[model samples]
Target chain A: MWDEKETDRKLCIICSKGTLDMAYPGLVLANAALMEGIDVTIFFTFWGLDMITKREMSNLKFTPIGNPHKMNFGNRTIGIPNAVAGFPGMTNMATSMIKKEMDKLEFPEIPEFLEMITDAGGKLYACRLSTDMFQLHEEDLYEGVEGIVGATDFMELSEDAQIIFI
Target chain B: MTSREIAGKTIEFDEDGFLANPQDWDKDVAQELAHEVGIDELTASHWQVIEFSRSDFDERGEAPTLRRLKVAAGVPTKDLYELFPKKPAKKIAYVSGLGKPHGCI
Candidate 1:
């Protein structure tokens, strides 16, 4: 009932957040969309580029400040209030806990997920403005990153796609 | 739980018509369910998706989301749409007797 047209077949996901937790939604969604045989392109801008950066990619840190507590301890999924996230060493604890839980589920690590997305035929692009502002070179990006693109390029490319911002 | 009678069997379903108990599902049920959703006949390719969906649901204790199905079922989005039409993910989950996957579906 949302629209008379057939379901959208192409998806454009924008990733602007850089935290480890913030990265999964875009990555997992892109992975899922590609699997469904939908064409997917992910635009990583601002801090999001850290996800695809060869130097700082794999060990991206989780910032407990203003982070939502997933409340997952061990294998149990819980929800902790955001207020508690401000305590000392909370970011470290949260990161370790989340990594452990993700590992238990056999989900690929961030680097592996990026590779999987590219291998699965999804496209990855870094924002040109962000790259230039940050002084990052193409050599600083991981393999399979389609060159840095500007806002206009992304909008034109995604004109026919269902846009998702994360 | 709601229900629809298919092939003389009373199969329970959730609000969106996905089979409440996936075990209530069978080939006859799948074919009948497909018809209810506007698929007049189930083709070999359609059966491929249903079989994969059901097996994956059984193995994972969860319905394979479109992403999981892409890897495990080996069917692309284009063909899935051609087979099941609009909202293919939800339709396939219903036709294949699995719960609705979480998200916009």
Candidate 2:
């Protein structure tokens, strides 16, 4: 028999990408879970560590290269070719466009989003090996990060919880 | 939808228990809703959030998200969690008789 009340629902989200588009999904999911009274833990590894690195968190970029979706500008849907998207300033342009759209929807910046999650009781952790590979220290991470932990520690922390990899 | 007697008045609720018609809310109904969600008493702090949410909903026709509550209503996110416990956004909306917040954040 299923016992809904006896089960304390939990969610563990693994963020492995650093791009601006990649970052928000994990964050938004974590925030939504916390809003619903579920326990949430987020693990940052690989390029995703950029999401918590103080120097890079706010400056994360979105690259439209290889993405086939057409971007809507006012009433027009324009698709950027891979070649054009790879031009020098294209990344910055794409990043700013995405940022503007996100702002219009009232999504907070990366650091502020992390603060909201932490304040709402969501847990954040950096993957130890990734931090070492990237030569990042505890001080380099956002203040809300709990700690740097290995895979095993993350497993223990996320025990009995549903897992999401982004 | 389901109907329940809360605070001596019959109230209609949606599938998730949010008020079907937000107009069917009053202070007494809010108190009972808060109690149903494990809040024993509606303290000044709790009422602060509830009142702000109701008025915000009235203007926007939607419940305020935690960020809106913090930025617009001047309630801190930390205080909201403490007041509403685990689910501040949904709890505040439920108690305020507003629809669920649609934004992911």
Error of 1 at B87 (Å): 5.7
lDDT (CA) for every model shown?
A: 0.78, 0.89
Best by TM-score: 2
In Å, candidate 1's interface RMSD is 6.8
Accuracy of chain B in candidate 2 (TM-score)? 0.95
In model 1, pairs of residues that clash are A37-B77
* Candidate 1 runs further than 4 Å off: A1-5, A9-12, A28-40, A65-94, A115-123, A133-144, A160-166, B1-12, B31-60, B66-92, B103-105
Q: Over the stretch B1-105, how does candidate 1's per-residue lDDT look in tens digits?
A: 776678889888776556889888889988887877788999999998888888887787876655455556778655776787645677788788888776321
How well docked is model 1, in DockQ terms?
A: 0.12
Give per-residue CA lDDT, model 2, range A1-166, as digits (tens).
0011322799999999999999999999999988878899999999999999999999999998999988887787767899899999999999999999999888999999999999998999999999999999999999899999999999899999999999
- If scored against the real structure, what TM-score would every candidate get? 0.63, 0.93
Model 2 misplaced regions, further than 4 Å: A1-7
* Range of the 10 consecutive residues with the lowest summed lDDT in candidate 1 chain A: A1-10
The per-prediction i-RMS, to one decimal, reads 6.8, 5.1
lDDT of 1 by residue, A87-128 (tens): 788778777877877766556678878876776667999999
